[model samples]
Target: MSRNGQAFERYQKINDLFNRRKGEMAVVTTEEILQKFEISERQWRTDKQKLEELGAKFEYDGRLRGWRYIEPFNFSDNIPLTLEDMYNLRLAVATLAQLNHIADFKDLPQTVNKIRKAVGRWVDHEAQHKAIYFDPLPQYEGSRHLPFFLDAIEKEQQVQFDYFSFQAHQPQNYRFDPYFLRQHHQRWYVGGWSHDPNEGFIRTFPLERIEGEPIRTGKYIDFACKPKGFNPITYWQHVIGINRPARGLVEAVVLRFNRVQGKYFESQPFFQPYTILERTEDKLVVQMDLMIEIELIRKIASYGHEVLVLAPATLVEVMRSFFAKAAEQYTPR
Candidate 1:
């Protein structure tokens, strides 16, 4: 058989295993697998892996002499939805409704609608609407281009688009292999590999400022163009928001917040690798190990007198300069 033929046979075997598993009540016995599938244990293991890749949960039971789904599988009857499940569904519907743009996600909106119709009688619409609400963010002008970028990422293709650079005071053309899309503070951002300025570096662009349309360039040969050890998740792990951190090693930042502010931090700690060094009646001292980016500086400064920079003198100076500039802007010349 040809390569395509072999692939098709494998797919058929995996599908057959899925159907058999779906029918079984308590577990799928080894005898059933051997008689129906007529495959060796190793081949069965391979088929199991393929099923798992397709999101089918299964586990082997020695005493039962069979495999069972991690969660009970019931295809015929409707699974009972608890009040908590209804609440989550409500939030899902609300969030999907907010994304007015992007026509590709039509099925998601429809699914949310179906969920609402199914659970309408049980769930309290008005109370849940008030209690769990996702605040709307600024609508992106070029949000229609989201599909094009997503396609490029899926297919490992390069894309071209016109972007408005605030610093340059003009629109510039960009061509790069689309990597990942991230949402921060209700804003969308795309991170990718670009070779415009130098050899190449991973960079991020705000989706809102992405002007014109995204043109699919071509397929990206990952090995040749991309850096050997580049992983977007690891690259942006230590930083906050979309902006790159201050050019240096990640530092340990200690801050003291007043009682009111400390209470807020205690409730919702922002950065990861966070630790509360000391807590007292007067203030709360917390430490976070992360890159000292401009966004981080602004966040700390936003607290004004409530937050004080205890360590990392450089960040403290940045904070001081930030406040001084603000004061100067207000002072008469």
Candidate 2:
């Protein structure tokens, strides 16, 4: 075989070894690879270099006496899925179907069956019967827009769609470069740079409120010069859910939850880096730094009386106004 062919064969075997032994044990030691592949130490070094180039994050640990994968990494483009990988994909599709209520990827079922057949494993009927499940919430209308928006993002093109505005009571035509698609509280959102000359800032559009299909404008965006500090995910990370604050400010929000509700948050926190200030039999006080948005108020209101906003006097007043209005609605006139 030519040198390139030999290198490709070596890389494939190395990838298979890594995939098979991943998480169960580490066969990443120099000595181990040398023994398993019957390669010289110099060749093993070359293989390690190639793996790193292909996006495998392998870090050497003196304590473990072997290299460990910092995260799950896969390099093969068209390789058959491992049994575990196929099973996880199946669970993911089922979960998406349950949650979104829209079959976004039309060929997902067929693709999954193909993966299962490729594995050629016996059907563990008992195991399959008692598998993963999801208590999915109601369907989001915008879920159907996922595929189109994704295609637009991939193609780096402009899209025009009819956006319905609840406040305006009419649908308006909007043209924008679809940059990112995100899910917030089970609702899908597409955000990107608006083509309107007057408004150059980023804007997010709710999928549910989209009036019709998104049409491609046949215009391309040169992402090679895409802004230096632009990251769609990072842009909304600090904001509460999907609402981007008009006057964006990240402030410390202290909340006190009742014991019952607090226990739920202990396992699944509202946001990461939440510091537990006080934990008692009756109440649990925690704090998180987040951007103030209307969605933040909605989230607190969802818990009703179980959660109380303890700090940032501005938020307290907002919550107070919210409750007073709520109280009036419940009160007899």
Candidate 3:
């Protein structure tokens, strides 16, 4: 009754009724609605008309055994935000209004309106918020797997897929007990346990290599469920890639990031799981004790003198052999 708008009292009653019924058909009994709002049955009709004007359709469905929201409702449009919420909304938009999505947030006009209303900011006539892109669209079919895999995580289920590991270069059957989904370097990946836990006696399957029809094996294994104990940051900690054994020999991987590159990395890189043990006089040191990726050698090669692969003789030799070939091509008379 003390809520902030003319229709606020009605708003609370309808939202409460829908929630109380736990998302079933939301039809409220007319008598209960009147008692809840402390209004007469005639006044209830007036309020219902007001709700209908705001894009809510409430129909009496005898079959549903209660009132239903019909098909859709636009709660964001009808509920106005407080002024404080406006600035908060702007900050959130500034931080996250990037990255391309399939359905196109551009087409989510309702979402746009909600943001505009929530911020109470200028919706038009000039520069407001715009989408930015740094990463290109993933050129494969599983680019859209982020959302679907997220659902599988919430449902605590297993999934089957036709997978292609970059190492293997061909697709194979994979049943994964998904642990978590993570983002690193603009790529989406599902991290999980598999009933086929050992790929070749020690490694696990990578989900990106997974392709084609993903069978939704919703049957959950309570004992094998891993999300409860899996900490993504520490799990990937000191981990070079998915193929490495979870527990093996830890190495001190040393590399430098100059002032500019250090900040660039801080802004973007998913560096967790890799412990940074030192910062030297002229550079920042990143150390991760994980299996060496032959590709990581090339990444260090591109950094040139800016990064040094100090210690770990095995990795240094690997980098040496790779760059030695490049140095051969640069011989000049």
Indicate which candidate wins on TM-score: 1
Cα lDDT, model 1, residue 229 = 79
Residue by residue across 1-333, what tens digits does model 1's lDDT show? 766456446546545454556434567776777677677877677767765665567877787688877754333233345577677776777777777445555567777667778888545654455665566656555456667788789999988888897898888888788788877777678878875765266688888788777788788855466767777778767776687642636888999999999999888877776899999999999988878888898889889999999889998898999999999989987
Report, for every candidate in turn, its global Cα lDDT versus the true structure. Answer: 0.74, 0.78, 0.62
Per-residue CA lDDT of model 3 for 206-241, tens digit only, reads: 345666657787756554345355566676555545
lDDT for 174 in candidate 1 is 80
Off by over 4 Å in 1: 1-27, 30-77, 101-108, 123-131, 221-224, 246-248
Better of 2 and 3 by TM-score: 2
Compute the lDDT of residue 142 as modeled in candidate 3. Answer: 49
lDDT of 2 by residue, 271-291 (tens): 788899999999999998888
Q: List the residue pairs that clash in candidate 3.
A: 26-67, 27-67, 162-211, 163-210, 164-209, 237-273, 238-273, 251-289
Q: By TM-score, how accurate is candidate 3?
A: 0.56
Off by over 4 Å in 3: 1-88, 94-100, 104-109, 125-140, 200-209, 221-229, 240-248, 256-298, 328-333
lDDT value for candidate 3? 0.62
Better of 1 and 3 by TM-score: 1
